[model samples]
Target: MNRPHYILLPVNPYFITFSLACAFLLNLMPWGRLIGVPDFVALVLLFWNVHQPRKVGMGIAFFLGLLMDVHDASLLGEHALAYTLLSYGAITIHRRVLWMPRGVQVFAVAPLLVVAQLVPFVTRLLMGAAFPGWGYLVHGFVEAALWPLACTLLLMPQRRPANPDDTRPI
Candidate 1:
C-alpha cells in the first residue's frame, strides 16, 4: 500500500506521538525508588515497531534515547545504542510477534526488556561506571510489569484509525 494508506490504515501518527509523549512523561515522573521501572521508551517503541513499523522505527528510538541520556545525565550514546538495537530487534520479530496472543506477547517482551536494560548497563560499565549492581536489574522487572499497562493505555481508540475502510487520510 501507499504511504497515505499506511497513515490512514489502523494507526494514527498523532496518537502515536501522543502515546510516546505520555510514556516520556511517565518516565520523567518523580517516583523516587519506584522509578526503577524498565525503559518506557523501549516498551512504547517496541509496540509501535511491531504494530506500526513504518511509522515508529530505530531513528525515533535513537533520538528519544539520546534525549533521555541527556535528561538522565548519564554516559552519552549508551541508551542510544540500546534503543537502536531494541528497535531493530522489534522489527526483526514484528511479524512473528503479531501472530502471538496477548499473553504470549507479554512473555515475549520480557526478554526484550531485560536485554534492553542489560545493553545500557554493560555499556555504562564499559565506560567506567563500576558495576551498577543488581538494583539496575530491577528496572527490567518493573518494565516487564508495566508492559501490559502501557499496551492498554497506548492501544486506545485514538491510536487506531477511526474508520477501517477509509485507508487514505482525508
Candidate 2:
C-alpha cells in the first residue's frame, strides 16, 4: 500500500533526537570479531532518505558523519566522504524506492551501505592505516540483516501523512 507523506512536526524533533541517540548507542554496542553492528546513524539516515527525502538528505548525513568521525576518533573525513556519497546515492534513488517492496528496497540499499563502509576503509589504508581485514565487512552484513526491522521501526505508515501540511515538514 502507498503511504502518506504528512509529517509530524511537533514530535519530529524528539524522534530525531531519539534516532540519533539510538545511532550512538548502536555504535557503542560491543560485538566480538565475528559480527559487528551496522552504522545505526547511516541506517536511520537511509530510512529518512527513502521515506522522508524532503526532510533528511545529504546535508544531514554529512553533518552527522562528521560528528561520528569526531566521536569515534577515526581518520578525518573518512566517515564524511562515505556519508556524503551514500546520502547522495540514497537521495538519487529516493523516488524509485517508494514503489519498491521493502525487501527490494533493502537489496538496493545493502550494497550502497557496504560500499560506503569500504570507502573509508580503503581511504584509511591509503593513508597508511593498517588493513582492518575481512571482519571489517561485518557491519555491512548486519546492516543488510537489520534492514526490514529498521524500515518497520522508522518508516511506519502512520508516521507519514499524505498531506505535507498535515504534519511538520521536517
Candidate 3:
C-alpha cells in the first residue's frame, strides 16, 4: 500500500498562534496533576516544528517554555531547556520523519519526547528532588502516541482532498 501525500496549503500564522494557545490552555487544565495528562504544549510544539519549522522555530518554543515554566512553577528554565532540545531534535530530523509512515515516525520521536521529559527530571534531581517515578518517563511515550491524532487535527485546515480514493491524509 502507498501512503497518501498531501499538498498542504500555506499555513496561516494566526492559525498557528491560535493552535499553540489552545494547546497551552489545555496544558493549564487541572487534571489533578496527573502524570499521564501529557504535555500538550510539547505535542503541539513538536508538530508545528516538524510541519512548519520556519514559522515555529526554537524561539517560539523557548518562549512557550518560559510560559510553561511560570505555570508549572518548577525550575525556571527546565521546560525552556527541554522544549528547546525537543524543537532542535524535531527540526533536525523533520525531513526524514515527514517522509516516514506515522507508526514509524512515532518510534523515531518517542526517544526525543522521552529525552525532553528527562531533562526536567534530571534538572529536578540535580536540585535535590527525589525520583518522580518511571511513570514520568512513560508520560513522554504517552505524548508520543498522540502524534498521529495531532498530525491529523493540526494539518486538517491545511489539507485538501487529493482524490476520492484516498480516505484520509496519510
lDDT top scorer: 3
Tell me the tens digit of each residue's lDDT in model 3 across 1-170. Answer: 48667678889899999999999999999884577888989999999999899999999989999999999898899999999999999999999999889989999889889999999999999999988888888879898999999999999988754453556644
Ranking by TM-score: 3, 1, 2
Q: Estimate the TM-score of every prediction.
A: 0.81, 0.80, 0.91
Worst 10 residues of 3 by lDDT: 161-170
In candidate 2 the C-alpha lDDT for residue 60 amounts to 82
Q: Rank the candidates by lDDT, best first.
A: 3, 1, 2
Residue 158, model 1: lDDT of 43
Question: Under the 3 Å rule for N, CA and C atoms, how many clashes does model 1 have?
Answer: 1
User: Where does model 2 exceed 4 Å of error?
Assistant: 1-11, 30-34, 157-170
For each of the candidates, the C-alpha root-mean-square deviation to the true structure, in angstroms, is 5.9, 5.3, 3.3
Instruction: Give lDDT tens digits, candidate 2, residues 1-170.
Output: 66554443333756766786788677666653345757888788777777677777788888888888887788878888898888888888888887777788778888878988888889989999888898887787688778889877765644665565745554
What C-alpha lDDT values do all the predictions have? Answer: 0.77, 0.76, 0.90
Scanning candidate 2 in windows of ten residues, the lowest lDDT window is 2-11
Per-candidate count of clashing residue pairs (backbone under 3 Å): 1, 6, 0
Runs in model 3 lying further than 4 Å from the true structure: 161-170
Q: Which ten residues in a row have the lowest lDDT in candidate 1?
A: 1-10
lDDT of 1 at 65: 89
Alpha-carbon deviation at 97 in model 2, angstroms = 1.2
